[model samples]
Target: MRLFILGLGYSAGHFVRKFGGAFSHVAGTVRDPAKRNDLAGIEVHAFSGSRPGDATLERISEADVLLVSIPPGNGGDPAIAAFADVLAERRRKIIYLSTIGVYGDHGGAWVDESTPPQAAFERTRLRLAAEQAWTNNGSGHVAILRLAGIYGPGRNALVTLRAGTARRIVKPGQVFNRIHADDIASAIMAAILHGRGGTWNVCDDEPAPPQDVIAYAAQLMGVAPPPEEAFETAEMSAMARSFYASSARVSNAKLKCEFGVTLAYPTYREALDALWRAGEGR
Candidate 1:
């Protein structure tokens, strides 16, 4: 099997590390030609332009599986906008990495794949629109994984705590779901192997408060938890504060039942503990 990735960012990179061995050929696009060295064996193509060049399209056409992890810009999905026609004709299995934010402020209510999107922000609206575009333009089976806040290795709360940027901002009754990077890769691999088509929520078993996660990370690191600041009085950027607006407990029932996935890090505590032991925060 040949696998091609549109954006080899963090999550997609993890996917490659976990599953690239299964494919006979692997290639991906990166915005910077200078970072080609970082991609190791995979063929790296320049994708910094408005549309993929002829060489990139040739790579896209040669793949048996494709994963898109790029966010939509104002002009919309770069891949879909550029090669929707070509993609519609390919027999490739496609997966689009999307966010759980599309479900919008559920008032801490539980949500699943069946719930209709009620996007609360322009970013999420764009994601929803991009998802629809892929669904409409593509003849191949597309599995959309609506992921939660992703954390692993250098990107978790332990790193934030060590950096002295960990903040315990208390928002009463507000909770958010999260998934470890390895789990995200695992879920994607499951989707690829099963050839499932449709939307699925990819997250851990627990939905927790932001403050609680930070506190737990602190405990694991043997450090004092950051001082609490009520959300109303906290000094934060608009983007950071906007995350609190969508308080939903995302369910992973579909991921487990439909895809038969067993998450490597089923909860934030498990992931944080493992990262801490591995000295990821240090």
Candidate 2:
């Protein structure tokens, strides 16, 4: 199998790391020249502009699977648009990494694949549109992975806690869902190996209040937990505040039932605890 990834962000990085040599050929794109050397052994190409390089195009055409991790933005994805014609012709399987934010504020309700996306935020609305663009381009081989807030290793919110920057903002009964990077990678692998297409949520089974998570991380670090702030009065940037606006208990039942996969870290406590121990070199 051949795999070509259009984006090299954190999720894509984990995907390639977990499935690099499984394919006969694996090629990826990065925006930075300095980072081009980061994807050693695997073919890496620069893609700052809309145009796809010759090597990148060839890799896409020959790829059995094309994974796109570029998040939705104002201008949308030019690389995907640039290769839409060839992609339509190749009939290659495509996986687009999306976010559960597309579901909008569900009032902490559990949502599954059957639920229609009612994106209430601009970013998620853009994502919904991007999802449509890909589906409208061609066949049904495209699979969309709607991931939860991804945390693992150095990227965990625990780092923010340890830095004494963690905030405990209680928004009544607001809840959040998160998934580990390893679990996200495993879900992608399951989707690929099983050849399943359609939307699937890749999240952990646990959903907890934001304050509880902050307190838990602080407790594990043996530090006094930060005091709570009024959710409405909490001082946060527009983007950060926007993120806290939505609350939902994202379901992973579809992932387990359909993909026959179980999370490596089923709960935030387990995941954060593991990361804490690992950081302490225990």
Alpha-carbon local distance difference test for all models:
0.89, 0.82
Best by TM-score: 1
Let me know the TM-score candidate 1 reaches against the reference structure: 0.97
The worst-scoring run of ten residues by lDDT in candidate 2 lies at: 33-42
Q: Each model's TM-score?
A: 0.97, 0.94
* Cα displacement (Å) at residue 247, model 1: 0.4
What are the per-residue Cα lDDT tens digits for candidate 2 across 195-255? 6578899999988898898888888877878899997888888888888778888989988
Q: What TM-score does candidate 2 get on C-alpha atoms?
A: 0.94
Q: Using lDDT as the measure, which candidate wins?
A: 1
> Global CA lDDT of candidate 2, please?
0.82
Q: Write the per-residue lDDT of candidate 1 for residues 160-243, one digit (tens) a residue.
A: 999998899999999999999999999999888876589999999999998999999888888999999999999999999998
- Tell me how far the alpha carbon of residue 160 in candidate 1 is from the true structure, in angstroms, after superposition: 0.8
